[model samples]
Target chain A: MTSSTTLRQESVRETRAPVEVRGLHRAYGARQVIRGLDLRVQAGEFLCLLGPSGCGKTTLLRTLAGLDAADAGEVDVPTQVAIVFQEPRLLPWKRVDFNVRFGVAGTRGARAQALAALEEVGLADHADAWPGTLSGGQAQRVALARALVREPHLLLLDEPFAALDALTRIRMQALVRELVDRHRPATVLVTHDVEEAILLGDRVLVMAEGRIVRDSDTTGITRDAADAVALDVLRRDLLRELGVGG
Target chain B: MPFLLLLAWQLLASGGAIDERLFSSPAHTAHALWMLTTNGTLASNVLVSLRRSAIGLLLGVSTAVALATVSGLWRLGEELVDSTIQMVRTVPVFALTSVFVVWFGLGELSKELLIAMACFFPVYLNVHGGIRNVDRRLVEMAVAMGKGRRQIIRHVVLPGAMPQTLVGLRYSLSISVLALVVAETLNTTSGLGYLMANAQQYLDTDVIFACVVVYCLMGITADLVVRVLEWRTLAWRTGVGNR
Candidate 1:
């Protein structure tokens, strides 16, 4: 067990950068959301942006995903990028399978791909189920499946698991980690949860006032170490950054 | 309960509590219905009305959809057409009937054209609103997924706007029928409306009542057909109907 664990740790340590955003800025009317934000996501690496509400983490992620245009600066992204919003945002009129394969153009093999994606998310049984009938967690899983099926090179998540309960959130986090590792896509996750950042991210970026304050490598820490030391340290550091605590 | 109410109405009319001249007894109305059915005039008039309504509905809905699509896609087109339609929609169908009769003469063309015009605005407005009201996020998602304009329209915009369009279609259908009847009365020599108008001249209240009943039945049937279409086309929106 120790040997296998060490092997896993060593593998994750060798990260390759796939996406680079330099001095990205975004402003909504008078309020500047993301200002001079610079981020680099390694290929096959999980990076989490931790911040308080309105700290511009989501804005940064959206900018990276190309959903929101950057006000200034450059973003070098892969041709294929997928985003998972806080809400599932599934097409309510489509069944689970169709929603998963919504991005797949043309009809000939779309159904087959949709079914396969549903199977990947463990929702094959719900292929024909309407999106309205899905639970929150289930819907999020479908959304993740939707992103996954696109075979994206860069995956941006905007507090996707924030609304889920503790246990379901953990399960989903593990599922996401597994899928990311399998797909080997460069992933950027935005969240306010320090533990989540420490548990799932190879690197944790701390943001405040529309700028990144710190970027820490947590790749060397094991899950138990993350829970015991890394998370607590990151939490204190993030709180301090926000002027909440010393 | 409806039958009981009708029976009560029949009793009152037969007892002379209601004037038989204006309010014909149910039995007399039923007898008139039977006579019309036997004479085949009712069936022919019904066929004529049905044909006009079907043509008007088809033309109205297709034209509305085509116009809405074009306008929704192009800003300049929308600006030009939207104001014009809104202005025209304010003109009452009854008021337009005389103008149509004068322009097209006392024929099926005038009646059909008037019905189509009446049906056009409601559907066009709803479809336009539906397209405009589509969630921007969904459109962005589609664009991110590399969907072209046509694909977005086919997969996202049409489906999202369907419920609202269907509601408009239902309203337009009923309006079409009402307008068709009025148009028929004003211009055509045949149709249920014409039969009722002629009966009124002779003070044939039973025939008038029978024609009115037939009109109500046609309206109800049209509504039911639309409901069925809604159910079938929007099977994806099963529970969303209540909303």
Candidate 2:
């Protein structure tokens, strides 16, 4: 038992700086979005960020995803990083499989890999369908497939399930948890839902005004072995940090 | 409904409710068309006109694409080129026929130039707008996925701007035909315009009616050609008017 525990810790330990961000400062013209922020995620860790709207969680995520350059920061991440925005953002002109195949490594087996990714997302049947034809949830599933197709070392999810309905949102949450475990990418999911943060993240960080206000270690209470009391305490803490009534 | 219109016209013509000297009967117009065809007048005139229209369309589309690329992609080009085009495009190009004749003389060159100028605005304006209005989200998505500059251009920018560019092509097509009529009126010796001109000199109402039919068919053919191109190129589009 001790040996197995050691092995598991080693597996999730920091390998080679999958996502190491420090002093990330971002500003949109005159208004500052993300102040000097520091963050890190381990090799197989899932980190959820909880914050109020316009609290710079997305700005931090975009900086880490390399979509926007950090004004002043130390951002060390692997080149194979995949990010899903709040919207599906699929190319309306391309089919589902082509969207998955986009920018995946190795052109030789890209088609087969795209198919496998789509199958994992339960969208294999929509390979040839246009992005415009799919329902909202289905289009987002295709987006998830596109993110996983790269087999990335760092995965960033910026409220990917926020647009979904209640049922679809819960379903996607489970699927994402399972896929993140399997792929084992250092993941950071920025979301407003406190329940989602506690359910999926091994560690949760609450942000306010472009900096982390509370960081909670939730490794002791994963979804599978979730203690109701512990989960409630963490949820209350996050909600309070986000300036909402617990 | 079109068949009924022709039937009504034929009834009015035979009953003398419509003057045959003014409005030629459909049967007489068809007979005149047959005479023009059999005598090779229609064939020769149509070939000359087809050559002119093709050249003008090609030149106009090429020039518009070149200008649109420059103006659409660069702020500097937009300031320099787009403003000048905006200034020039509003002057009703048909009214420029006399100016064109004086500049290039009443020759094939002037007719083709006028048609080319008429076609320039629709393609230029629409394609420039298309390039400007390409979904910024897609470009950001591509960049987030680590796609480089060339790949973003190839995958996102070009294909994203295509639907509106094709719309520009359709506008250019209809305008080209309209410009051809105005252009061919400038003193050239060959084309449907020339046929109508000769018929008008002798009051050949049947032949003039035949020429009108030919122009209508050409307009329909232009629209059909654009429809077919859109069907092939924009096969992924599945909204209103697609079916």
Candidate 3:
């Protein structure tokens, strides 16, 4: 029994990449969105995708999350995927707690887990409050709690903090980093912010026109005195690649 | 305001400011109402009208809801049902009473059909519009969370559409009353319209006024019931005004 259990675990580890895409192609009518994009994300890796608007960053994320079908591609993504969009997307008619457990089944277990997730986000007191009463940041926290309660294998964030104020955005960024580290789900964050990519990513890949242009390893430069200078240089390079002045 | 209006009306009628043949004093109308109720005339007519309107509203509103759900949730249902409803809705439903009388012989069937037709449009339009207007982002979120199609409709679609659906319900309630008034005019030996018509010959303005007051009260009561339903089902909708 022990041998079979070990074998099953080993087989799982050997076979499944959290996310994989090869020669992906997607189009909207005559215009192409993703053009032969190829990439892989390992389990527990945090990859940040930095690109200009309309450069297929969101499209790629949606495709991987299975919210949109790819026109043609070899894509292998875990079925257990959760996404956080720029909008909170909480159902207005639902209470905050129910929204957190939006799609989870087994009512009793889901409610318990949802409350725990709300507690993690410091919103346990708002369990019965209507979503309409929540402030933007509070609503977004509920959204994050909703995603987290799923215990997803792949977490996709599409500019989840883009609508927030600077202070709230920073706080949310820290929360996301903390969650990602603690839970260690393979994460893909799509952002237009070069600084955000630098701060939160294990690997940052710059994309232009649906294909990756610059891929870098920034695993060593997070909050270390020895790598501060390297981080700055990388930031400058990334900004230039994104067609923004550093 | 209504009480003040009634007071002014009573003063005008009692003081002989308007012709007695046309206008009756509120006290006289009240007396007529008392007499009619004691004799069971008002009770029987009100019961008849109420029963007809209730059945018509139930049938019409349920059909509207079912069709709207099918059309709103599926492209095929929309294609098959929506265009036809839109075209039919453009025709004044009350104007079909003549054709209905000819076909159904001025019976209860024609009156009920007329009332149902009147109730159908507003409910159907509001429900369809509400369902269609549900935020696509929320639906996408549900899909991302791995909810099935039926589950999406249950959790996201229905609740999201509820406010608009209730608005439609309120509109249909008023429309149903209006239709019931018109429908009661067809081959009626029964209902408030019959009492009013009988009073018209004798120039018994007090009875006519009493019937009018009863109709007004019925309309107001239906509106109040719908308002209470909105309040109960939509408690979570407090922070934002109805969208």
lDDT by candidate, in order shown? 0.83, 0.85, 0.87
lDDT per residue (tens digit) for residues B13-58 in model 3: 8888978778888899999999999999999999999988888898
In CAPRI terms, model 1 is classed as acceptable
- The lowest-lDDT stretch of 10 consecutive residues in candidate 3 chain B is B234-243
Report the poorest 10 consecutive residues by lDDT, candidate 2 chain B. Answer: B234-243
Looking at model 1, the pairs that clash are A16-A43
In terms of TM-score, how similar is model 2 to the real structure? 0.93
lDDT of 2 at B87: 92
lDDT (Cα, 0-100) at A230 in candidate 3? 90
**lDDT per residue, candidate 1, A53-105, as tens digits?**
99888777776666677777777777677888888888888888878878566
lDDT of 2 by residue, B24-53 (tens): 999999999999999999999988887888
TM-score of chain A of 3: 0.91
lDDT score, candidate 1: 0.83
User: How well does candidate 2 score on lDDT at residue B37?
Assistant: 99
Residue A34 CA displacement from its true place in model 3, Å: 1.7
**Per-prediction TM-score to the true structure, in the order listed:** 0.92, 0.93, 0.94
Reference-based lDDT, residue B46, model 1: 89
TM-score of chain A of each: 0.87, 0.89, 0.91
Candidate number with greatest lDDT: 3
lDDT of 2 at A187: 94
